[model samples]
Target chain A: MSDLLTIENLKTYFFKKKKVIPAVDGVDLKIKKGETIALVGESGCGKSLTSLSIMRLVPKPGGEIVEGKVNLDGVDLTKLTENEMCKVRGRDVSMIFQEPMTSLNPVLTIGEQLIEVIINHQKVSRPKAREKSIELLKIVGFSRAEEIMKDFPHRLSGGMRQRVMIAIALSCNPKLLIADEPTTALDVTIQAQILELMKGLTKEFDTSILLITHDLGVVSELAERVVVMYGGQVVEEAPIDSILNNPYHPYTDGLIQSVPSLTGEIKELHTIKGNVPSPDQFPKGCRFAPRCHKAFDRCFNEHPDLKAISDSCSVRCFLYEDKQEEEEYNV
Target chain B: MSKVLEKEILEKESAGEPKQEILRVTDLKKYFPIKSGVLQKTVGHIKAVDGISFSINKGETLGIVGESGCGKSTAGRTIIRLEEPTEGKILFKGKDISHMKEKELRKQVRREIQMIFQDPYASLNPRKTLGSTIVEPLNEYNLYGNQKQRLERVGELLETVGLDSSYSNRYPHEFSGGQRQRIGIARTLALDPEVIIADEAVSALDVSIQAQVINLMQRLQEEFELTYMFISHDLSVVRHISDKVAVMYLGKIMEIADKNSLYEEPMHPYTQALLSAVPVPKKHGATQRERITLKGDIPNPANPPKGCVFCTRCPAAMDICREVQPILKTKKENHSVACHLFE
Candidate 1:
């Protein structure tokens, strides 16, 4: 199958006051059909912005998608009208937000919310939509679907609320699902359950998922391909094994080293010193050079392109520039 | 494992004569009455902590692991008397301070059992400097009469947590999440409390910072001869830091055991499912392991399942599990499980 979603040099900017804040600057992404791609980064690194840009739902007032093409099956989503994009949202692509408690409507019943999505996207009556909602709830492993449907969002637990969010996202069975920090607010056990449920449901439906999270464990468990982002740019993209085993970019390396492992005793987790830079004050050369251990004069002076390293791995670092010159590597 | 064995040897020497107990909580319950409708009468209650019992030795970490709304935070808060418990006996050094007057408790037991809150950002007052925040406990308990001594103590405390003393003048916002947590730790240690209840102290921090905080806590626990009630949702962090682990669900203890045993051979089906779901960061694919995907979400704690709270989602749940609530029964030494399977 062709690429489910292809984003090339997508730039999302926020016109705060008068100054422009480039949140997602020149981001490139590709999601294959029935594949799971993880967008890994620290907070404020523009991973969430990329997802928001894909859904054409950048926060109002200041934020807008300024440049780049979001191609879904050869259709440029960025060029579409608001009504046209609305049609594409639930039917062609859907999104699961970060916090389930706030994402879900407090006053509305779970069944009402789920059915509303179905009724809005598809030509279905209320009764038919309600039936579909119940079926979707059951599909997401919510037993006692009838009872849960009647319950309001506040009445359910955190995990249950997240499940409802997933059910709503998957109500129309969109080909692609973009989950942004889906389990960040959840506890580990509940997070595991939700991750398993998402993986199972997505596999069952043969739906592609773009899992955005900072947790490497989740990526290792769920993702087939990994896209590591730093300072609003894709620093590294590779197969899961390659990224985990032999990450090329310094940022990806730092991320891997930082995650506390279950097997061995972690004496000292390697921390990337300094906070993620604000969008307005990005460095001139390598955005990661300020915190990278492998930074040199050359790295500080020049920005590196996303160069292909191997058949399965690509990295945006000066260290891998020789590999591309030696071998003609193509995706 | 060898390091653990060696640590145990060192603990025996450092612990000296085993004191009878440092802190004991019996049938601790914290219920918040929910009022609704036109009348605003007490319609129901949110039983955040419901009838839980545990004890802490003089110098050991007792980890409480549970999902959100499982009452782990409430249990810790109630133990520290931050939120008054509905019912329970908080026996400190054999003295039941449960019914002690607020003034009396604040004078005696409050300083002895300090608590670290979850959000470091909200915990520390923005107006106060790090020095003042840490020194407030010293002033409250009258540990130091002079300002110089208090400043010295604050500096020492900062040094203990691997932070520079120069950060004393910095406000909460000036520091990172890890640095702020260190300041919180320093404040908690100012009273030189016998028992410290760390309620998700490092959960808000990044993974790398979490490790640093955990290491600092372990070191401080050893140095201060402190007993800790470490409450957290991250099982891996809990397992690494805790000597004993208690698994809670719906404001009740599901299982409690030694850290190794709990992870290696979990008895309760909920524990099993929880353990299986934890993504192991090894080369071996987790897919090979049979993950018990609990069918339903956690039941509402306000009105939990009739018999067992876990029965709603438990895979090995039988009719007995649905008919009767299981009590915590000791299956082995230092191990207790609340499930019909054990019976």
Candidate 2:
């Protein structure tokens, strides 16, 4: 499969008068066509910045994508002009924010918002746009798409508003959807409904998804592959199952055990010691070494590059750095 | 009022129910008035906590789980008299304290019942040091020793909540999310509250830190013999923390059962959908994880479905479920469900 979205050595930094905060430091990720990739970490780990950088929507004045290239379907989004990027935003790549109720314009009706996006992207008449909006809402599993379109955002329930958001995002038929904690604000039951709806609709449209969330359980449910980010960098990247059951990076392993699950027999949860360091205070060597249980002498003094363990999996840890040790551990 | 914990009381019939039921809520209701026009006349009310009844046995955690606007938080607040109930009775240790005057509540119910809020940073006093924050509560109750002794007690409380006694000197901003949460727990523990109402206490922390706090909470519960009303929307967390779980919707409980029975054999359709909705860490079947994803959002609490609060979204919702409201009735030995399907 061709790469739908490719991010190379992406470095986004927040500039202050005296110091520069490298929120997303030397990150790399790739999402293939029709694949779902989950980027996960604790707060301040820079997962959000990576998504913002891809969309060329990083907040201005302080934050900027200092170094890196983001290519979506052979087109470098980083090289696109401001005006041209506007055209591509909804037509080629769309984003669904964490909170739908707030993200949706409170002043506008659901139909008006949906119609505006559809007409702006597609060469459709006003009536045609309205019809397309209704169709999009139906695809998102809305029972009364017609009624929902006439209603204002506040009139609908949280789940309904989220579905409407998805409907608007899908109106343009974008190849890739960037969903940042789409269901975080909804209930578990509603979350499941939304997740299932997104999965089915995206599959129908053959659109790849870049899912950014904190919940390990949600990541396990939706994403085909996983990229474990820490200190604004990708620590490990692998297929979802491989990352879940046998993560090589100590951070990923600790993270998996950290999430209390239903299946595990373990009594006490294994805690990763210490909080994620702020961008400015990140450790000198391996950023995770300060809190890593398996940190060795070299781990404290030097950083390890992301190394491939298998054809599709990789880890950034010195424990997997030595060729002989890597083979032994792999065996 | 409450047919609550009768089974648990009977099970411990020989040992004579260790630690007589600390808190019992019988048919509690808390409604926020919605006024309209310049007159500010009563238009309608958002039935935030519509008639709900449950009890917490001494030395046990009773988790109330639900989605947002489901009244889980409202239930917790109402129980502690933070948001006074519009109707129903609150019996803490078999005494009706539901309608107690604010002054009387402060004197009697206040010290015994303490709350741990969701946002640790917001809950803590930014202007106050960790020592003073915890000590402030102690000072209010005229707790243990004098000036020097209070400082010593503050240090002890800090240690009990798994923070270094030295952290008492640090400000709230200096501590991480987990540490701040620890400080909040320390404040909750400082009063020697027999029952702690933790409202989404660990929901804000990262998974690893959340685990640490949970473990700390479980440890503290055993040490202090604390009865917890753990409120959260996270199913997995509640499953791990609670001894008996009450699933609430639109301010009314859908089901209540012992942890094992509820997780293993969920009887209510709402419960069934809820359990299946929780995504497993590893794919057990991988391909065939049958999820009962409910349709639509939770109905408006102000104008809830006439029959059942959950009737609007229930998959197996019948005509009766749309007409006659079903009250919670016993199903199995220790399980109860409020659903027409159960009937």
Candidate 3:
């Protein structure tokens, strides 16, 4: 089956003064129908920018999607006009942000906000939209859906607000759902609840999700496939099980090891040596080579392509690159 | 001003290990008042921390884990007297320092207990250099010798936190989040504190950086013989750094036990749900962690449920759970729970 959303060489850049800093440099990803693909990376790794690029919501003036093809449901979003893109955004792809408090309107009641989305996307009356909004609220796991419709966003807890945000996002029933760190601001229990709700909703609607987060635990639990982003590029992409158990990329390994386990005896956490290079200061060759433990001479001078290491795994590391391709490198 | 407390502090001055109980709290409560209308009449209160009791031993890390708005942060802040307690007692070295005056507390107790805030970006003054930030505490406490000695101490502190001494001249903005957290730790350690309360300290950092900070904190704890109240919502982090753990829900502790006991055999339904909810990055694939997705949101602190705070959401809640508050009591060796299930 063709992908619900396909991103090819997506590059989102920030223009500061005369310099252009690549935030989401040359990245490729494909999410099929009903697939939950997580974009895992630390802050400034361009995961958030990539999501913004897909939604065509990159901040104007300085930030822009400099280069990329964001193909959504057989149509390229990049080629769409402003008015055309606006129509496709909520109806084809909706987003859930990290902080629900700021994401939602403070003055408006929950029902007003949800109904607005419903009416804007679907050909429904105010009464029909109201009914649809209430249905969404209940679907997102609210028991007293009618009561919540009357409540303002501020009256609800962080978890409830996030749930409402999810409900609103699902109200349009977009083919693709971009949840960028939707649970980061929430507590673990609340995070679990939100992730479960998201998964359940996706199953019901047959929607694809691009779950962006820095936490691996969240990715492991919620996403089926994981794309490890580092220095504004994908370092590895594989099944969730493969990424957690046998991550090939040094950065992926570092992320996996750095996370202190909760299952058994606690061990001294292993840390990646240095900081993630600032966007402007990204290295000439491999972006992660500066901090990577096993970087050889080749890593400092040449960038490894995002090559397939196995059937279901793709890693961008010189160590896993085919030996037959080594003849093209240093003698 | 209690004679027993005075004697206890004196005894604790020369106190050794095996004589645990570095800090103890008895029936601690903190409530923020809600006011209404013209005259600003008191309209109820937000019971941030309600009648909580716990203890920490010297050189031990007591972790308090909970969801947002559950009062874990409030409890930590209240311990350092950052927020005035509405009621109850906090005994440091057997001294009830909760009611101590600011001036006296600063002299006698404040230095002994320090706090590392969650946002290192917000905690440090952006205008001040890292050197000055670390030295500010020294100046306040009047520690170290002359100007040269103080500057040297600051440099040494910078090196101890794994940052180069040369970076001391740089402002807080010049450092990364992890480095800034280290700077925060250095400032907290400046006064040679006995108990350090870190409230979501590492929650802001990246995974790899968080590890560095956690490892650094663990090493420093050993070197300084520091007792830590590591308050965080991340169970994995708390499990890694803590000797004992307390699971709190809406203004009250549902369970408290040694780290192994708490994680291994969580008795309270709330604790079990909380633990189950945490996405453990272990035994992936088919061996999925059993999850208990609780329904509804946490009740507002001002108007908690009639009986137990968790009764509204607990999966194992019984009829008694809705009518009577459960006291946190020991059920096993060093393991305690506040649930009707055990009874």
Candidate 4:
């Protein structure tokens, strides 16, 4: 079966002043229908930019899709014109932003926001759209949907606003839902509710999700496949279990260990030594080599491409070069 | 640990009776009055920190974890007198400081308690050098007179926080988030504070950097003999650094206990739900866990429910919870819960 969304060689470049900084350099991603694929990375590692590039919503005047193909169901989204892209945006691909406060219009009523999306994407009357909007709110688990629809963004709490955003995102029942840190701004309990709602709703609609976040915990809970991104490059890609249990890439290993757990007590957390370098100051050889504990002379001088380590696991690191040797020994 | 021992010493001194209470807050309330129209009369109030009471041992780190608008930050601020309490008695070293004069408080206890804000980008003045930011507290407290002594103190503080004194001249913007946070820690330590309130200090940093900051905080707490009221929404971060943890709901503490006890065997239903919700990475396929998805949003503090604040969405809420508010009662040794079910 073909993927719901297939991104190939996608590069998003930021032209700050005059220098062209490649934020998402030579990236590849695939998301099957009803599957949740997580794009995990530290801040400014181009994870968010990759989602933006997929949606063709990169901030203007500075960023542009320098090169890449964003194919949604064999239809190349990159080839579409601005006007044509508008039709595909809410109908084919919808995006739920990180900050619900800013993403939602404070002046407009929740009903108006939901109705606008429904009417724009689908040929529905204003009355029908309003009714559908309430239904969407109810579906998203908002109690007294009619009452909530009358309320403005300021009247609702952060969680409620996020629910409204999800309702709007799912109103058109798009094939793909791109949630960029959907629960980042929410509390744990509220975040759990939202994640559960997203998971349940998407399954019901059989919708594919591109979950982008810095939280590894969310990735484990939501994603079937995990993509570890660093310095705008895919360092590791594997099934969620393989990536979590035995991460092949040093960066992925460091990230998983860094996550504080509740069940097992860790005496010391594995912390990556340095900050994620900006796109402009990206290291020459390996982006993670500066902080990687396993890095040696070869790691600093040569960049390793994503190599298949197992049937379901792939890693970009020199440490996993002799995969067969380790496999044979284990066998 | 040497740090834990240091805290014991500080606790002993602060408690005075060998069982000293470093900080005690009773019926703390901070309501931001919302006024409308030209009259601007005291119409309604946004009960940011409605009413809370907790005590911190002289040397222990007390973690305050709550969602936004849960009043954790406000509780910390009000306890420190950064924001004046509406109605409460903040007993520091067994003395009431809730309504103390600013001048007298500044001289007596202000320097003893310091705060580390959440946002490093906004907490430190961009215009001021890191040296000035660190030294400004010293100047305010009149800790030293000579410029040389002050510079020496600043340098010591920088070293204490694992930052180089050479970067003192550099602006805050020059440093990364983690480095800036270290600077914030250094600044908070300038007054030789006995108690420190870190308000979401590591929340804004990267995951890798968060561990570094948490370790630094743990180390500094011991070195300075500091008692901490660590406020954050992130449970994992709180669990990492805190000896004791308090779960806060809308303007009220839901549960409080030792870190291990609280995480291992949570008594409160809310705490259990919260713990279960946190995702843990597995080796293979996702393992199913009972996730209690709480219904509805947090109720507005201005018009909080008459009963238990958590009763609105609490799965284990009982009939009595709606008619009567539950008073925090001791459930176990050093553990307290405010749920009616426990009662």
Per-model TM-score, in order, reads: 0.89, 0.94, 0.96, 0.94
Give per-residue CA lDDT, model 2, range B104-189, as digits (tens): 98898899999999998899889889998889987887878787899999999888877789888889999889999999988888
What is the C-alpha local distance difference test score of candidate 1? 0.86
Q: Which residue pairs collide in model 2, if any?
A: none
Please rank every candidate by DockQ, starting with the best.
3, 4, 2, 1
- Candidate 4 per-residue lDDT, tens place, B161-214, comes to 888888889999888999999999898888888999989999999898998888
Q: TM-score of predicted model 1?
A: 0.89
Better of 2 and 4 by lDDT: 2
Which candidate's TM-score is highest?
A: 3
Once fitted onto the true fold, the runs of candidate 1 whose alpha carbons sit more than 4 angstroms away are A17-20, A124-128, A142-151, A187-193, A267-270, A322-325, A328-331, B1-20, B33-46, B148-156, B285-287, B302-309, B318-325
Best-fitting candidate, scored by DockQ: 3
Backbone atom clashes (below 3 Å) for every candidate: 0, 0, 0, 1
Q: What's the CA error at residue B262 for candidate 1, in Å?
A: 1.3
Could you tell me the lDDT of residue A107 within candidate 4? 93
For candidate 2 chain B, which ten residues in a row score worst on lDDT?
Answer: B280-289
lDDT-sorted candidate list, best first: 3, 2, 4, 1
Reference-based lDDT, residue A79, model 3: 92
